[model samples]
Target: MNRLRTILFATFFYILSVPIVMSVPVSALFGRRAVIRHAHVWARMHRLLYRYIMGVRVRVEGQVPAGTYFFAAKHQAMFETLELQLLLGDPAMVIKRELSRIPFWGWAAMRYGGIIADREASAGALRSMMRAAKALKAEGRSILIYPEGTRVAPGEQPPLQSGFAGLYRALALPVVPVALDTGLVWPKHGPKRPGVVTIRIGETIPPGLPREAIEARVHDAINVLDRERRDYRMVQAPPAA
Candidate 1:
């Protein structure tokens, strides 16, 4: 039954994605706002499919802050990647360079304000990412980045990529750590299960702290929902002073 639902969901999602993806170029004619409007529509449609067809629902704890913020989220599955765009009102997403090369989708991502970062930890790549992030910040757009750099199983909590710290320091924006249990339902490989994925927004950490301090805070905050962790439950800390 789950397999059937997955198949149906994927089929319809792909079918629905075509026209929207193609329309991105057309949206560009109307300017960036039109492109973002179309992107938001695309994200909302995916959410609807998740709720009605996949039987997956999202429960967000804590309000998403207003204005520009550095959103650092856990990467457990593909679910949050699209969901965050809608939830955060279309922030500039930090996506991999590979994703930015995918023909039309890549073109749309760039057009819609995605920051492309190479996975390799080279100085040049870091510089390039900072430049893009700064550009978006100047435009009054928030940024969403998966600090772990890749998805992991529900129980695993890997150290954040160096790029995360680099971008954090470069952007100097308050960081909102987002924790979730999406991997429990949306496995990296295989059909997704129907369940409520809880997204817990942690307190905003101020910018300009040392690399280690910021990284540690973000690591713990983003792992609050990891049941396999020592805490074994969600821990919502008070807002940072």
Candidate 2:
């Protein structure tokens, strides 16, 4: 049943996607509402897949941080990305440069809201982020950031990216730490297995937590979620929206 559903969904995606991707001067008429609507539809479909098809369930324990938070989530599985999309709605995402080159899809992401950053350009990238961050917030959207940049293989911790602290400080918004242990089931792609998916909605650490302190705390929170030790209360949660 899932296979049939997957194929049907795939067909629908490409049928609508090819023209958008292949069109010349793609950005010429990309409507903001269309991109936002389409992306969330994809997310909602995946969310259903994660729950019913994959036999995975997400449990959020804390409140969602309020008033334009700087959402820093640990990226062990692609699940975090989709869950955020489903749960938080489509807040403007800050993505990497590679996404910008993916023909039609990439162009759509950028035109709508995705901020593609050149990881190598430290100062310049920071400048771009500040601009992107500001623009997104102004649009009444939140910033979704993956501090580790890319998903590390299970049991491996990706080194922290250098600019999160700077970005957090600059944004001066409440930082919400989100932790999910979805890698065990999802395993990055191909056929997914049925497993318990757990996500802990952590508390908002006030901005006064120094950048290093904030980084350390959130990283530790994620590591603890990685452990999946016990179902403890998630700290500093944003109110359930």
Candidate 3:
């Protein structure tokens, strides 16, 4: 039954995604927000899909803001997005440029006010992210960023890149650290496990502090949350400056 349900889930996602892909060019001609509104409605459908079809349940800790904030989450599984959208509403992600180039998901991301970043571009990437984030914030939107950048397996930690600190330094907005036991269930590469996934929204840490301090604190914050609730535990602290 689970396998059949998974197949249906894949089918539903692809079928709905086609229109979003085709509509990108038209949305591009209009404005990012115009398409973003459409995408928001589209993503809501995904929540229903996960809840009713997939039977996925989510539990969130801490608080989500009505205003704007920079949200950073540990990347492990697609389950992260469900909680993010549930908490912050329409999320404009700081994604790789590759996503913006694809049909539908990529194009709609661009047309939908998502921040498509170029890691190799160096200077320009920071500026572009800030601009996109600012625009989204002005429109009463929350931004989701993955500091670890990519999903990895259980017990493995991805190196947090420097761009996260740069963006925080530039924006100086409130930062929320989110942690989840997503990899345990919806792992990067594995058969889906049946169960509820746990997530927590940490207190908003303000920017304008030292980069090392901010990054280390966020790291520990997530680790503490994940450890308390899951099989994971922190092994080492950030090296001294």
Predicted model with the maximum TM-score: 1
Q: List the global CA lDDT of all models.
A: 0.91, 0.70, 0.72
Error of 3 at 47 (Å): 1.8
* Model 2: CA > 4 A from native: 1-31, 230-241
User: Which residue runs does candidate 1 get wrong by more than 4 Å?
Assistant: 227-241
lDDT value, residue 71 of candidate 1: 96
Candidate 1 TM-score, true structure as reference: 0.94
Candidate 3 clashing pairs, residues 3+ apart or interchain: 21-104
Residue-wise lDDT of candidate 1 within 98-182, one digit each (tens)?
9999989999999999898787879998999999999999999999999998889988989999999999999999999999999
What does candidate 2's lDDT look like per residue over 122-184, in tens digits? 788888888888888888887888888888655666656776787787777787877777776
Q: Which candidate achieves the best lDDT against the true structure?
A: 1
TM-score of each: 0.94, 0.79, 0.83
- Winner on lDDT between 2 and 3 is 3
lDDT of 3 by residue, 2-117 (tens): 77666677689779867766766776677766676666656677767767777777777777766778888887777666456656766778888887787557756665667866
